[model samples]
Target: MMPSLERASHWLALVCRLVAGIALLALLTVTIADVGTRYLHRITDGAIALRVSGSVELVSYLMLFSLLAAMAANVEKSQVVVEAFSHGLSSNLKNRLHGVYLLGFAALGLILFIGLLDSAAAAARHGEVTQDLRLPMGPIYYLAAALSLLLGLRSLIHALLSAVFGADGEVSHGE
Candidate 1:
């Protein structure tokens, strides 16, 4: 891979992480606000109208987008491993297992991509809206679809890179 391409990917991943972190923080803040409002209402009037508008749902979807967008960085760094048994394996076996793992994740990403896209389209067509908040679902669905598609692209790239470079351990020198 060219140096510029690698750098771009790294930058993209970093942007995704930043977006996700901000969305997550927003989600937390919303949750806290909702809780505080509810508590105050309950103490004051004994009946709390938990009237959180579409922002609540918006934050939720944005949070998911942030997570999906950052997936490539996680995979590239091997930070998403369940490595109890793999740590004990021989180098050859570990390489083979890593290949399998990468491929499996790529396949999963593809599935999620297709599914999310379809769901997004359906939401748009049907004009689906959240029940309680009456928020438009199309934007959330579309955002999720976009994020999932990006994740699939990232998984595909990582899988291809791993196949060519050999996924031996945490640190990849790149072939």
Candidate 2:
């Protein structure tokens, strides 16, 4: 890869990681606040209008963003693995198999990315919005599509590296 492209990829990955972290923190905060507000409202006989509107929709979107944003990093680290049947394989075979698996995941990610683009376009055309908050869904879907594309590219790169360099290319966590 060109140095500039490599740097860009690194920055994108970092941004995604940051987004994931923020989403998780926001999700936790929102959950706690929502629960607390509901409890207070119940005990106080509805004296305080502290119940957050559209919280459920917000949380759902946050969870989706968090999961999507973390995909590239997780793929790079080789965190998702199927070990049920591969425990007895030789190291060399295992690495090759994993490379193949990553390639498959890349293909799946590509499909998802394309599908998400179409979904986003359709949502925009229809002016679809969250039921409670009326927040447009198109932009969120576009973001997810972009992240999925990134994940697909990352997975493809990792698969190629693993195929070429054997065990050195893959990040193994002893799982």
Candidate 3:
């Protein structure tokens, strides 16, 4: 059961990473096209004024997705570690400290998840939409909330495993 869960989590993290990468690429493409179009319009004196409507809103949402998708993998990989002071600690001590740090991360992720849920509820109730695209904000908020919940769970699992099995507690997903 534990192995299965670990495998599932690993797959989830991989999917998230792929999604983040795609979102980032899409964002880059949109930004480049928008900028190039505007530049061409400027230079051409309105002859080739091909502006993408609602591009700012689209880019903002893409950025949000990219950030949310990458967060779980980042937590799982312990990529955000701050080694300012504990760099020379013993492996056991470091693992313990990392466990504690992961707990803290879980707490923060929980807070964000709750906040996103609240924001989603409010947005749904208020019929909030992007100014240009009129895209409903509630769905995006809810998706982010879900991803944040996953991140929190991942962090908590990592914390518990680290506490019980030390730094090498992490199960490789055949990667």
Q: Note the residue pairs that clash in candidate 1.
A: none
Tens digit per residue, CA lDDT, model 2, 27-130: 98889999999999999999986987888988998998899889875675663456887778777776667777789879978998999999999999999987
lDDT tens digits, residues 1-175, model 3?
A: 5566577667777877887898899999989999999999999999996998888988998898898889876675663556877778787877767777888878987998999999999999999997899989999899888778878877877777676567544657765
* Leading candidate by TM-score: 3
The estimated TM-scores of all candidates read 0.74, 0.82, 0.86
How many residue pairs clash per model?
A: 0, 0, 0
In Å, residue 75's CA in model 3 sits off its true spot by 1.3
Q: Order the candidates by lDDT, highest first — what do you get?
A: 3, 2, 1
Rank order (by TM-score, best first) = 3, 2, 1
What CA RMSD would candidate 1 show?
A: 4.0
What overall lDDT goes with each candidate model? Answer: 0.65, 0.77, 0.81
Cα lDDT tens digits, model 1, 1-175, are 6343345555656666776787778788777777788787888796766645665676666678767866755655653456886677676666555656677766877788788778878888999888768877787777666666656555555555555555442333233
